[model samples]
Target: IALECILLLILQQIAAPGPQESADDSPGIALAWKAHQIIRSRFHLPLSTAVLAKELHCNADYLGRVYRRTFRLTLTEAIHRQRVLAAEKLLISNSLSLTEVARQCGFSDTSYFRQIFRKHTGLTPAGWKQRYCKEHINS
Candidate 1:
């Protein structure tokens, strides 16, 4: 009877859901979500993998891995995407110069901003603004 009870306990333990099985409840998912929130709220500030990891109190490499796994993009890519979205809004809503737009969007270098903006938007900042203005004015 003692042997049967021990075997049953072992089987129950084996069948139970462990931390690995409940991926949605894992810390990595939480960390990734927190990182996403931080990026969304602070994208206009300087940020990076190390900066985010420090803010989240996790290892930078681990944060990078988890963020990439959860979002299918690196931290740098996510930051750039957020910055580009902000730039797009500024480009359309006002007459801010490209350099000012870059500065306000957290890009330290106007040239790099142009490159990344073009990469994500398929148009230069000036070109995008011109097109947007023309389209909206005609409407």
Candidate 2:
């Protein structure tokens, strides 16, 4: 009985949301969280909204609506943000080139990738990396 109780407690902790996160965040927030999990689960693979929708058991349009409404950003924007954030981490800690980072982050075109990075971050990828490294070194 004690072992079962301990297992249940552990499971509960694993499933529980953060203390600062409220249960009433929104339907979109819930959908975004689910989407985030699905993306992370298949991070190594090429993925799309159609694929994600199938995995999530929802229509692509509905998923997009929920995602945008909940997060105040389009699904594409959300996905790009995740990809860029991953790229940022790699840029800071790894020796991968910009093209390599773009490829690894799901951007097939190097030029388009640079444009998107600049659009989102207001800095070229190289500039972002330089500033990031400088900040870290100073800190």
In candidate 1, which residue pairs get closer than 3 Å at backbone N, Cα or C atoms, i.e. clash?
none
lDDT of each: 0.85, 0.74
> Compared with the true structure, what per-residue lDDT tens digits does model 1 show for residues 70-99?
667899999999899899999888888889
- In candidate 2, which residue ranges exceed 4 Å CA deviation? 1-32, 40-44
TM-score of each: 0.81, 0.70
Candidate 2: lDDT over CA atoms? Answer: 0.74
- Scored by lDDT, the top model is 1
Candidate 2 local lDDT, residue 49: 81
**lDDT of model number 1:** 0.85
Residue pairs with colliding backbones in model 2 are none
Summed backbone clashes in each candidate are: 0, 0
